[model samples]
Target: MNMEDLTWGQFKALLLAHPNLHLQFKYAEDALVDASYHITEIKKAPITSVDCGGVINNWTEIIIQLWEPQGKMGGDAMKVEKALSIINLVEKALTLDAEANVKIEFGNSTFYTRQMYPSAIAVHGNDLIVDLRPDVTRCKAINRGGSCVTADKGEECCTPVKPKVQLIDLAQTNCCEPGSGCC
Candidate 1:
């Protein structure tokens, strides 16, 4: 609800404080971005239905559309799954929001976690209440101690770059249950 720097710990606190909040997402990319992903060509996304889904009373759905993939991107096959995974990951942030020690720095501009709800969902037009909020996190390389530890309290394995994300979380966050941070 607040737009300011937040440590992972602070973010955890907020989500833990209010675990019932839901999340939604919308992705708008230019024709160029789409074309690049497919490695082919997309004249334009006349009315692109990017990805959609989230907790509707508890279940979340996710879908993605790209121009096309010519070769076998075995990883590409999991595109939809990845989207959902992102949702799940973020929900962890929320459920563990109370336990997160958030810290972020974007090139010279030091910052903290901030909760951002899409403007599209802000409208109380329909009889719909916003169920999710997109959260912002500082990428690992850009922030302090943003490295990935595949196993906690154990030896560090692969350290990956922090994701520059535009992620959404549902109240139950689809992948997370009440009081469970999707861990």
Candidate 2:
């Protein structure tokens, strides 16, 4: 199933009902985090930025941070019910936006720390597989409009224009040279 199709709240509700399911995160084809990882923190990140075209953009995300404890080995993964309990605890302390997008934050000595979005979810035997994809940068202005800068492709928008340079002959000018009286 496409995990992106569901909001954070809907996903949490699904998990809460599936008490026996196990979770495994696949960051890449070869990069997988098994049950040894712990849900260290649940955060609400609100981001606001001005795009290259000077338009302001704002959004929020439910950030889930996973940590693999040192010297930990393959073990029974955290159950879905246990994760729901953690979420409940977080909700008690801080309000979470149910409709906000969900992002998983993880990294290791070999992998740089980064936030990834859930791309897909699948059930493999007894495990719930979550495939995470890296977020990409896009030109917000272009996405919101046909032109790069503005919607109307008017004077404020970016348009291709031929470059021109005017050449001036210093000798033909009235301005004086070092010895000229016009100096």
Q: In terms of lDDT, which candidate is strongest?
A: 2
lDDT of 2 at 32: 82
In terms of TM-score, which candidate is strongest? 2
Task: State the weakest 10-residue window (summed lDDT) of model 2.
Answer: 151-160
Off by over 4 Å in 2: 1-6, 151-183
Q: How much lDDT does candidate 2 score?
A: 0.79
lDDT of 1 by residue, 21-133 (tens): 33212222211111123211111112223211111222112212223333423321223233344435655553433222222111111212233322232322221122223
Q: State, as a TM-score between 0 and 1, how close model 1 is to the true structure.
A: 0.18
Please, what are the lDDT tens digits per residue for candidate 2 over residues 1-183? Answer: 456545788778667666798888888787787569999999998889987676899988899999977766887788877888899999999999888889899987777889998888777788777788888877777877566755444544445555786665668875665754454
Q: List the residue pairs that clash in candidate 2.
A: none
lDDT of 2 at 68: 77
- Local error of candidate 1 at residue 40 (angstroms): 26
The per-candidate count of clashes, in order, stands at 25, 0
